[model samples]
Target: MMGVVLVAGALQHARVHAQAAGFPDFTTIVEKAEPAVVNIRTTAKVSARSGPQGQDPYEMFRHFFGPDFQPPGGRQGPQQNPRNNKPRAEPEERSVPRGVGSGFFISEDGYLLTNHHVVEGATDIFVTLTDSREFKAKVIGSDKRTDVALLKVEAKGMAFLPIGSAKLLKKGQWVMAIGSPFGLESTVTSGIVSALGRETGDYLPFIQTDVAVNPGNSGGPLLNLKGEVVGINAQIVSRSGGFMGISLAIPIEEAMSVVDQLRASGSVVRGRIGVQIGEVSKDVAQAIGLPKAEGALVGGVEPDAPADKAGVLPGDVITKFGDKPITRWSDLPRLVGETKPGTTSTLEVWRKGKPLTLKVTVAELKADKTAAVEPTPPKVVETVTTVLGMEIVPVKEDVQKKLRIKGGVQVTAVQAPASTAGVAEGDIILAVNDTDITSPTQFVKVVAGLDQARPVGLMVRTGEQTRWVAVRTEK
Candidate 1:
């Protein structure tokens, strides 16, 4: 009888636990959010570059058909098509279907949002509503960096979704996604937030979820339990070219920012500080006396740019830009890009075991492409001295002046610990640990005094990039 009582008690506890883990009912959320969602179809004009009679025009239209297929009219000169008067050789540009995606209206005036790739290169865009009403849409603008586009339709009284904050999202919170996955319009999928602020690129940190997103779901709305749109479904991680339980969304806040800019100027302008940044490793942090591995390590600084003028340098770690703390290397770019140009912002950098603050005037980004590496080193050698298994020599005066360095020793040869640490020939050693080496003789003395048991930090510059390499003195 006691065993039977215990079994009943265990089953009771299990039932209570199940009750606490309440499963969500998504039918209500779908009913409210589905009307705002839209199905997007695009068409592009592609040239059907076959011959006049669809024959192979091999070798400039002479090698095929025994060289008798002369012109568009055979025995006569070039003639126009009877139906359209367009040259027969010039194959008529056809409006072929390009792709299908999803979107959502943001306002009642018919301004909608979708992915930039959806309408990219598209000649015609059409948006279909839940009521089966379709209207032609004109792209207001598109920003490829954020992959967001703004489109406008002639319709009025369209249903729009209320925007929500992704910052307030937490893990395990129920979220819903409405998109046209695989051309299935108004399809609804539900899942909990897998993660937030997931860094997948240098520009935007994505909101990662397990929602069922596929190719046709590129630009749909991701909503919270409040029936507010939180994100735009943008990407997925899969091997079979389909959903694999991982979908990424562009946070609605970020997408709206791009939309505002696109609506105002038909383009998005971003700020540039003119520095190439990289990750700060733990070893580098320890060697530089940083308390923790955080912030962006400056690898290269463009001359005469904002960062250069603000006294930023290679090997310095940027801890903060204005009021925003740079927690990772990729965080800096997004923060800088978001800042308005011509505004003076506060900058904080870690230099030589201390934090230095400076004011920088943010400049408008001229181009989106990365700057090429500069400063081609001159081949000149003088008084080679061997230290740390590296043959070092003073850089020539003209080369130093051209490179704009006050003093540094050029490494001509390397082996063992130095080689293992990635120091290479033609590399310029600018500093040993915390001290700048003024000459080849001084560099040799600095290396001789380094603790053999501990790895020493050497600031080495290769081409336009600078980094700290840690090498133990003993083999």
Candidate 2:
């Protein structure tokens, strides 16, 4: 009976252990990450007018009661002095503004990281430590594009967290966040990584998680299970402008790169390929005769760009850059931004159903360069109504000159065939019925060759590039 009791006790102990393993004890992680997180407060001095020349109340009252203060023009009141009425030396009002944010310590020597938006235009910055000690902070550098800022405080022996590799993070991995939200200091939250390579349309790809991030959580650290910061809490997506279980954190790998660049040069210099790329959809894949839609499809190449100089053309699918696989379309930017300019990198692309390799010398990205413009629009001539249910006009020289194009057809009015095929008024038709058209005669002939009820492919140039649009001919 004693032996049976021992067996039962062992089973009970095992069950208890399993239950404990299911949940992580985040107390230690919070304790370690909290000290590095700080509250940033900024104050701006506003100009105020010196108090109104010390108004003499006794003299003003006596003046109002004087006999000369008799009712002015039958009005039962003293006539106001024009000098005193001249706005009473309007007190100058200047706004003294204040703001708050959060930051994490990156170095023991007092280097800290926060968002550039937090410190931009700030006149005075004060950092409050976890222990409630405050110190004035100085901005070391700030990168507006990445929104990363480096700050320094005059304190020694400060606790800092080591940066973790975001590349090693996987979906569903546990993470924690410590930040100041709504002026509350050292608030800790936990959640699992929900997704990766999330594009928030801000050009910075982020790691998506379900962490409970709030307004004041920006620039806080997202800690991994090992107590290292793997990401920087940056933004959240919600209709109500608050956390709705969706949060985005800048990957530490990218954030640290920006931080290092800021520390070195007070700004970041990103490498440029000078090509516009779009994701290869299933339809595009089928059109391009690709086995699968897996790579970034080049839609346009900037003139004189590194990609252009390397003979990278539209319709080429970029499969790899250097040693890294171009798994997603968004991955290219992060990789390119991290690479130094003037570096030679190998690019693998698929062109015309065959793999091609090219060596490209990355160029320094010019901030103010304008994107490439497409071919000019064709002029409108005799309007011809087509079975596509649209009125097409012949190319005129004036229209081409106005559009600054060498050749193409100008879309005047789009109806069934054109509108249904996604053609718009400003679109310049470059090809119709698979025949290149530079004039109205050629355009009409190409359309005449198309069979009714069959799909006709038309290449239309819009904005900066040309895209193929398929429209069904009228029966």
Candidate 3:
């Protein structure tokens, strides 16, 4: 009887040890980090009588159509009642919940960090801690480009998470998130770092994780195994407006940089070199005598801009920005944007089958728009020209002078093909299929000669941005 009891005790002990070895306990980390996590709620005043029917536009369509009806490209359509033309009665004004998100305290004196989108345009901001303490928060500063905002509350002696280095984060390492997902306060989820340096946004290279981050998890803390904050839970790639096993967090290093700027100033100032760039295609790389398909291929250069002044031409492929390599096209934007304005930086580019370095003085990125200049025209001229559902006119001398451009064609009207291709009025046509459009006649002629079966690429300058648009020819 004693031997049998001893064997049973040993078996039970072995089972307990095996369970401990298989599943690591996370209760200690959660208990330590939950106090710093916060739930944020915002209120905004929205116009009760908006749109043609004097009813909530989104509600009218959604409620009437059973909530599944969506227009092309997910844009809301006109909410007009065919049978009833009279305006529906609605309240004059009301305050509604604008958004719900999560944040974390960064200092003991009540300084916190959250996503800028969480409190953007909110009339009232309220923050609640894990200990049931609530306070109204003041928005110190927010940077929309980085999607980071610094906030301050009136409370004191708050719990804060220690900052960890995101640069040293590796894949397949354990990580956890603490947030109020779906209004569930202090929800803790654990997962491994799926990947790092994910390019999902224009400015940030996000830290990708498998943590179950949901809608209300935005602006929360992504903690390491040591209870240190590694990143800020920002965005998740989902189709159903819920977590789909892929979540992205803004790296702590990038967030701290923005936080420092916000603490010092009300806005962020980033450097820019006036040039439109795209990824170097494999075919283009081979054609241009490149060793491999890499770097940012300059598509267009703004006149009198930093890149233009530094002799950075359109055909130059930027291989390196300063000491950092441009392995992908997205790397150039992040590197250049992080630099300060008026700072001179060296750019190493591949040009004409050789590597060349150019020194460029960075310019402060502003809200101003850059106009397109006329390129050198083709030698041959074709007689038969079609407008392709568009009416255009050559840029006048005064307009060209105001736009700071030599010459280009301006769009006056748009029809089916042009409208379907997103060609709106007030757009300027710079080039068509590698041929520079010097006049409206040349644009029409180029469109007429384009192959109807293949797509036609047009370099369009719309307001402040320039990009290539592929328009399908009319059947």
Candidate 4:
């Protein structure tokens, strides 16, 4: 009887312990994490609508109603309301609220993180903490490609959450988010990580979750049970402008790297090898002798670029960069973009049904390196070749002078990919992949030299404005 009682007691204790271990209580986490979360508000400048072209109210009334329409007060402006005997208010212009988002302190000195879109073009920014303390914040820098932004508030000894790695996170792991959803400050929501390495952006492998993130939660922190921030809540997959179980967050590792860059130089600089890459289709993979479909398919290598100089050829599928696996085409971009320029990275490539290793010194993207300048005309035109299904012709001197452009190519005809890419007649090609088009022949050669399996960026000038169009090519 004594042995039976002892056994029953031990079993009950074990059951209680199992229950405690299986479900973690987030009360402690909430207490520690809530103080670090902040609500962000921004304002933008806007011009007010002009009342009427003419100052005279009677003239404006006559122009709108009729030639002989009478004014309300007999040739005067709006009259007083008869019921209240009060003058009516006129519409006035002012700066208005632009956006609302959430952010969290990353350092005790008040450095914070948020989404770039939340603060882009904002004229004024304000942040509010859990204790109802508000501070005007400055935008340190923003990287649009990664959708990450850094901000600094004028405060010291601020509460901050410890950073954790999203790489350590697993699917079905419990996580929580603290944010301001639709302006509800200090709101908390919990869920399990739905997935990781989600290909949502070319430069980010997002951490997907089912947390009830909404509009104002754009820049909040996604925390683990330990109260450490693993990701920055960013995007939501929704059709009705509300959270419908799918939310995405930027991994903390990537966010921290971007924050460091933004803090140092007001902008993020990313490494580029100047090769256009596509996905390795199953058929292509099989044809190339791979056991399974994987890796980034190199389609176009820009002339004189780092990849071209490093012997990275067209049709070579990149299996790995440095030691990171390129399981998806998008993974290559994120890896390359995170790497520092001038770093000699080893690339494992699959070519001719065999593996080849190549060394590529990464180069900084031109847009991030220097401010854009107008191109000077070249004295001569190069040989002609065709790609992207566009007939190229040298721009007439008269047309070039009239358009204020030194040199360009005029599109004579569009077919196949060009037609589908919205290229039209009379559209002047200003540049190809950031290289200034000196002449029609040069433009043709540039296009022809491009691999047909890649997308070509064409700077098309239509009328007085110019825009970039990525022309798709047949793979």
Return the top candidate by lDDT.
1
| Alpha carbon deviation, residue 274, candidate 1 (Å) | 1.5
lDDT of 4 by residue, 292-338 (tens): 68888775566688888988865567899999988988888778988
Pairs in steric clash, model 4: none
lDDT score, candidate 4: 0.77
List candidate 2 stretches off by more than 4 Å: 1-21, 49-97, 314-317, 346-359, 368-379, 383-410, 413-421, 429-459, 467-475
What is the TM-score of each predicted model, taking all chains together?
A: 0.81, 0.75, 0.69, 0.66
Worst 10 residues of 1 by lDDT: 57-66
Q: After superposition, how far is residue 409 of candidate 3 from its true place, in Å?
A: 20
* Ranked by TM-score, top first: 1, 2, 3, 4
Which runs in model 3 stand beyond 4 Å of their true positions? 1-23, 47-94, 368-475
RMSD of each: 10.4, 12.9, 9.5, 13.3
For residues 1-475, write the lDDT of model 1, one tens digit per residue. Answer: 9999999999878777765888666777888888999999887775654323332222122211124334333443223356664545656666666667899999999999998877887889999999999999999999988889999999888899999999899998889989886579999998989998888663687999998877678889999998998999888776543467988899898899888889998899999999988878776777677778899989888999999999998888999999999988888988899889998998999988899999999999888656565544346546678888888888877767866787998888889778988888888888877788789899878777767766777888887788888777755
TM-score of model 1 (CA atoms)? 0.81
lDDT of 2 at 396: 66
lDDT ranking, high to low: 1, 4, 3, 2
